[model samples]
Target: MPNAAERPRRIRVQRDGPLIVEGPVEVVGEDGEVTVSHRFTVAVCTCRRSQIYPWCDTSHRRRRDRRSGPPGGEAG
Candidate 1:
């Protein structure tokens, strides 16, 4: 835990992306579960597409537009 005199941690909110937070960070879920990361920095998933919940695996970058068919522009 940080002391009262310690500076507040910084969290950067990326548009349509994960939240970049300075670590080590402790995340508490709605289920009263806790997720901890000791990395110097962590990307917290906001899109909820990551297989690893609460941790960003760049899944948001893989999002495909339904109207655009597929990556190769193949309509199936």
Candidate 2:
């Protein structure tokens, strides 16, 4: 039987950005370097803009994000 806790997780794509993963992982870069990291969460690049490649550096936030409301100078 496969160990449920040892299985690699598949990243899921959010509505606006790269896929988010939160389980066991084994990642390999194009240069053939491999790394295994365990965390409560992880993010994989989808837009291919990451300098580190395949990782989210929060760069996508600028392309897909904008405030929906007006300036808050008078909201107080």
Best by lDDT: 1
Question: Model 1, range 1-76, lDDT digits (tens) per residue?
Answer: 4434268888998876799998998888889898999898999999889999899988876785777656555311
- Angstrom error at residue 58, model 1: 0.5
Q: Model 2 over residues 1-76: C-alpha lDDT tens digits?
A: 1337756666677754667888455567888886665666778777777676677776655554245334332211
Using all chains and alpha carbons, the TM-scores for the candidates as numbered come to 0.77, 0.56
Which candidate leads in TM-score? Answer: 1
CA lDDT of 65 in candidate 1?
71
- Per-candidate local distance difference test: 0.81, 0.62
- Residue runs of model 2 more than 4 Å from their true location after superposition: 1-10, 64-76
What pairs collide in candidate 1? none
